[model samples]
Target chain A: MSLERIKIAPEMYEIMPPEYQDLVKNATYGNENRGWKDIGTSKELIEEHSLCAGCPESMAFRYILASLPAPEDTVMVGSTGCTSLVFPHVGIHNIHSLFGNQNAIATGLKRALTVRFPGRIKDVVVLAGDGATVDIGLDMTLQAWFRQEKFTTICFDNELYANTGGQESGLMQKGFVAKMAPVGKTFEKVRLPEIARESGCHYVVNCTVSKPNLIEKVIKNAIHIAREIGPTYLQLYTPCILEIGKNSMEGLQEMRDSEKPTERFAYREYISDQAKELLTEMAAKEKERKAEAKRQLASVKA
Target chain B: MSTSYQVLRGPEHFLPPAAASMGIRLPDPGQGHIHGKIVSEEEAMEAAARQFLSAKVPTIFPGPLVLWAWNEKAAHKATAVRHLYETLKASVTSTQQAMLIPMPDYRPKYPKINPEVEINPNHPNLTIWHNKIDACMFVGVHCHQANLSLKIIRGGTDCYTIAMCAQAGHEDAMLSFRDATAEKIMRLADWVKKLKGSVEPPK
Candidate 1:
């Protein structure tokens, strides 16, 4: 096909599977800015605190926090990036620390809270930039994974340092050039999911902000794993409009389109359901094994 | 077998007295089982000053190495060490080993201008733009500089000779060190610089 003919039309929603398109349409329709409905039980807890509504990162995070099942007494640890803006807005409690320190701080917080509250707080969610996690923060992030700290790290991989004027981050895909790499980037793109897996994170998820359903599923899974398995790493494909050279609307669209291939198969929902089933089975197996062990021990004693 | 070490005061001293604050605590120097004597803050300051005056080249580690550059006055070695240690500890894993070195007083040597060379005042999203710029500059400078050092070290005459001559006809061996160093430096620097000037910076 000719390049001109291949151009995507503005009105033509890309041809996705019928069921997938319907799901997208429904999800978008449901997102009617009913800010209150999205605000889960944590609304009351964070209502009194001054919201960091100014920054987009914070806005996105607040949106997610609102949707979470248990956001009560949750302490947020933000790195030295745009996400810190949410600290002021949430009003309840937060920490603004050094660059790439969010994961470590969140790890510590998760450990402390889980011990103190003992199943009261759900998970300590760390919001950081791709630069923080994949690059400078990699060691800390990897360490948290190895330690299996009970926390969820959400890396807002905008691919560039949005807070710092679109600098390329470790998460930036190959073939992309940044100001620092005017000559061109030399290192291969760092794949966060692969790295997280290598770092021993029991659950690692990659999703984009455009796929709210998928993002939500991944986030929910991460939270569940943080409660059950330990620490979970989630790399979120957050597009930086200013850095990624896309207008706000276009950026949002790109993010949405990025998920098209994966969404076609309803990957998020399928994975979530599968995980739930697997966990249930595992638990049953564990109980049976324990019972068998006890029976053998009693028999030996007799 | 007494190895001398200096104590640096890290940025943890500046952490707000809030529950959420990531505080700094000294890992019992004994934890690593290194038989080195931990020096006091004053001794560390003196040693750092000497190292700075001697023009000793500071080495960069593989992962993130926290360095304290005094923006205004000459930062004490102890202060820089403490900052680097706390920052590293708070950021990296306790198990992940990194060289925590105190930054020599660069302020007195190089006048501190806003290191950010590029700014986007007219960005459609002002808030996002400013934040991106700040983060890029902060991490970009260190990452870029570290990469540069690695490249120079690997591409140095001795390294080239060892690869090219010692391992004759081994193109892979000859190029490995130089290529890896160059790749790391260029990649990190490109990311930083792009964030500084790009119209649509990465999120």
Candidate 2:
């Protein structure tokens, strides 16, 4: 018998609890495969999970997962592609459903759990790949949002069916090239958040994985809104690492260096502020229209 | 000549007789406590690590850590396992031990768009083989260390172990395992390496 005692640093032990030390021991003994970087982050309070390492959107989802409250009651419905890969590694309770059926399954789960357990369950989150949400599951998603189902739906918009070897998805940007769309995708990318808003979803937000902090905040807020108000749609910009011709390291760096900064500046300096202003203007117009319609109805009745 | 192992036939092929063996009754399932509290980041880390340790077996020696981030509400654990494998460069470890044990078969009961049905029209054998592959992939990730060897009975598959290893800067184990399984022992030995700084996304 070979006896090898490894001594961990005092600082490391201070940062992590005894349970975590046991987890590392189990991992060593089990020979389980996982991304080293992600496993490292698992030591943090928030843990992110995903299907594809190459997809930027998957990485973004991971970042968002890192920011959420631990012992989360949220259930993630992963459609096919990158987001599907996150489930096993994250160590959270999750469901891997068929492609494009995340919304329907999530809707059923939310209804069932809420009905059975009542207020015990917190929220249901659907993590969809571009192909599943945009191409196949679009109809179900629309119905779910239109019905105002109580759930938080996140679309990691990577512009392709990454797991099936980078095929073009309905959400593929105009200039993007995928396996099926070798030359370029002719269809315009679907602005899913705007569609959700029009479909009568109570809340909608679009952000990229690049902004880890913001993504976390948005996820927390989205879950809250889903529970308090109704359904919430979050369109996340996730990059594809392999499909986009980059390795995992480069993909993460790209998200951190460019995606996060750009998103922060845009949301803080322009989008959110402008959105508030626009909402105010829209509310005034709606009031005027409603009053006019009431008067017209009254006059006709008279 | 009849097989010499006739005495060990039928359902009792492997297990010892209950009357003659140590019969320990497991605790009732639903009777267990259900503590549903939101864990802090620190607590979550500790819990993940502890769970990892409890689930691990030492037979394989330095198995890859399988981290599962389950979304509790969906009741869909299989998809989560698949997603974990894809993102992490991990494979499902199906073993015979898992088969003998009463593990939950979390495969979706509903109809899915089976790729094999559409891709191969003429070749029945090919379609069946492909379907088996798909089914295996779906159920494989949930297989624990003991069940890993069962995956090999089907042929042309690997039985990998799953554990949850969370430490500062130990993220490279996945890549290290991919590069060299032989180096896994050394990697585990070096688990004490501290993360250089905070794990913040780049600005």
Candidate 3:
């Protein structure tokens, strides 16, 4: 987003809301090096969200928004769920089409954007709930990958439909009792990251929001691969605290417990040859950029 | 008396104040109501039809979902929305593209859906009030955008607003119809047609 787009006219500055002014003056929209570390330090892309107080999805939104490599040129597509509640608060451009059609919308949007801005990188990212990704819109999601749509798809796998009274979702684990699954889910959890690999996603990662640094890396990798290679996917296990019978503060601990090395949500990533090469080159460039910046800082100090 | 709609409430105690601080338009959060009321599909449709018949100028803002359903019901849904507008003699307008980012030639024209032109959500109330529209219906809009737009309208103008959603109805709309299938929209069209037949059409 262009900072100029959000700038309030000087004549109307006193009339504008303070929070909006704060957003315009302090938001980290175009910072290349911004990450999860800027969560509370700077004005975030998401001014605020309406998610449950301790919802991990809320935290995931902040991390992902903060970690976007090109916030100025990125467009987010969201589906109907708790995630939708927060998109209005997000400062970046976003599309909330029909539920479960996020991937399809992103496919067209990415193509349109590419045509509109030739030779420029305009990232299209799809952020949806587990139900939208794995259950309701699974066919479209998979089809988008099969078609090799150049975009990133991130699923906030909260197990059940938390926004809709905790209904049973395909991402819900086996033998987990939910609203529809009164006797517990009878089937195994769908291995979406592996399916993403098989469905032609160039980069795939399965993890939780347990570590901010890892989340930042995963999001950047997914976006970078999709921009140059093909579709990429990130599955983040953002558990629903209320559904899991946990209180507000237990959300982070729940994610941490689920993502232990030996546990179900262990951090996993699969990178294709092209993606690996691209990442390596990009990493070297990033290192060089940092070193140069540090040298400039030291020279100034001297 | 039995209520036709369920009032949504946050599970946590602090969500109300916290959501408020985040600029969230709390719609009937089960304590003190902030925005509009949640009504049933029939109630919402009836209110919309009545508003259309009585208003000096009525408008229909069809969202993308109204143009196309997940099940490829776009043609039929568009037809029904068209029939509703034709029956009520309402002007039609919509947000051209779902994305809010400003771009040149950005508003992709969807004249097929009968919207002569599109308006941006950022200045929703100004466009509505400028057009002198007294009542408007939002059909097939994504819920979040619909919620934001509805709140902006409520806050700025006195235009009666109705939201017809495919999923659960929006609480922020003055009237909201949930499970908005093509047949349901056709039903609303018929109801409006019947109402228009009984009353003098708006000038």
TM-score of chain A of each: 0.68, 0.69, 0.96
Per-residue lDDT over A1-302 for candidate 2, one digit per residue giving the tens place of the 0 to 100 score = 00021222221232233444544454222121122233353453224333444556555655655544432355668877755655654434578888788999999999987887774745678888777887899998999988889888888776687777888777777788876668888867786767888786666776566656567667665665677567778777666777777877786565555344444213421123334454466559769988998999999999
| lDDT for residue B163 in candidate 1, whole number 0-100 | 14
lDDT of 3 by residue, B14-101 (tens): 2122222333332232211212443345555666777777666677776544432323465567667666666665322231111111
Candidate 1 per-residue lDDT over residues A227-249, each given as its tens digit: 66666777666666666566545
lDDT (tens digit, per residue) of candidate 2 on B9-119: 112223222211222121121111001122233333333222222221111211111112122211122233323223222211222111101112222212222332221
**DockQ of every predicted complex:** 0.01, 0.03, 0.02
Which rank order by DockQ, best down to worst? 2, 3, 1
Taken in order, the candidates have interface RMSDs of 25.3, 17.8, 18.4
Candidate 1 per-residue lDDT, tens place, B56-167, comes to 1211221112122222111232233333333333332333322222211111111122212211111111222222211111111232332232223223211110110101
lDDT of 2 at B199: 22
Which candidate model has the greater TM-score, 1 or 3? 3
Off by over 4 Å in 3: A1-4, B1-203
The interface RMSD for candidate 2 is 17.8
Docking class of 2: incorrect
How close to the true structure is residue B199 of candidate 1, measured as C-alpha lDDT?
26
DockQ of 1: 0.01
Q: For each candidate, give its TM-score against the true structure.
A: 0.44, 0.48, 0.62
* RMSD vs true structure, all candidates: 24.0, 20.5, 16.3
